[model samples]
Target: MAGLWRKAPSPCIGICKRPGGICVGCGMTKADKKTFKRRRSKGERKALFRILIERLDGMGRLARWEHVYRRRCDRKDRPCPLDKL
Candidate 1:
């Protein structure tokens, strides 16, 4: 049970701009963000993260997000997947 409560990495970049109900930084919709925060399954969270990454990439904002993501991760002292981006 304790093992099921592991922390999940977020896709936030601190540049939250919800234009058209979608965030420009992480490419998640307002509803998606809400669900993401409450999600408890590691696999589900990871899948969401991957989808966000793909969305960012498709929008041509992947590089910019990567830069901000590194800073965000550093501030939180968390590991980022910048290399994977």
Candidate 2:
């Protein structure tokens, strides 16, 4: 007997922004949040997992902010509010 299972997709779009403290595009919780100020390298799965946990713990507030930002960006002929700052 076999059970149905599928691997989740990688959450990396390759754009790294330090200001947001996370990937604004791919929502890569792991690579974006890992503490690597001194070293520039790719994070391992364990480090990424830790970041995922942290993000999940604060998902409500993050999701709300993302929604608000998206709405603000949706206006015609207007740049995203995030872009201005």
Candidate 3:
């Protein structure tokens, strides 16, 4: 079902921290967030999510990111992908 979509939803939680170029809310960097706007295949988006999850874990912020992400999904009336991850 994920592959059926033409564009991937962003993972931002709206809390951007410019000092480190990493979002303290969703754990995505500026570049990482920009990648979602590119013309990437669904599979590529899913792969990117995996890498993002790992990055969050490496920073010991996966739990925080997940919480924020879920809320963001709720606000956007979209399904949360954390279950898929």
Candidate 4:
């Protein structure tokens, strides 16, 4: 059972963030501060990269839509004062 677990693929992509931050995309938890420390096979890494790209693309689209909504609201003279709350 231990060998089966060991053979299971890792979730690390080579594109790691600085200071061991959790990946915003694949959500891979870093075991250490060193970048690319997780020993994932090439195939695993490629899959992780694809997931990361999809996550980023989704986030980008959401952000653009949010910006457009905010701009539209502003143009209509809607007073979005934080202090009003």
TM-score of each: 0.74, 0.27, 0.75, 0.31
Candidate 1 lDDT by residue in tens digits, 1-85:
3222234356776678987877898899878877876777656666677788899998899889878777877786766544433
lDDT of each: 0.71, 0.39, 0.70, 0.40
CA RMSD of all predictions: 3.5, 12.8, 2.3, 17.8
lDDT of 4: 0.40
Query: Which number leads on TM-score?
Result: 3
Best by lDDT: 1
Error of 3 at 27 (Å): 3.0
Q: TM-score of model 4 relative to the true fold?
A: 0.31
TM-score of 2: 0.27
Tell me which of candidates 2 and 3 scores higher on lDDT.
3
lDDT assessment of candidate 3:
0.70
Residue 26 deviation, candidate 1, in Å?
Answer: 1.2
Once model 1 is optimally superposed onto the true structure by TM-score, how far is the C-alpha of residue 40 displaced, in angstroms? 2.1
Order of quality (lDDT): 1, 3, 4, 2
Candidate 1 worst ten-residue window by lDDT: 1-10
Which model is ahead, 1 or 3, in terms of TM-score? Answer: 3
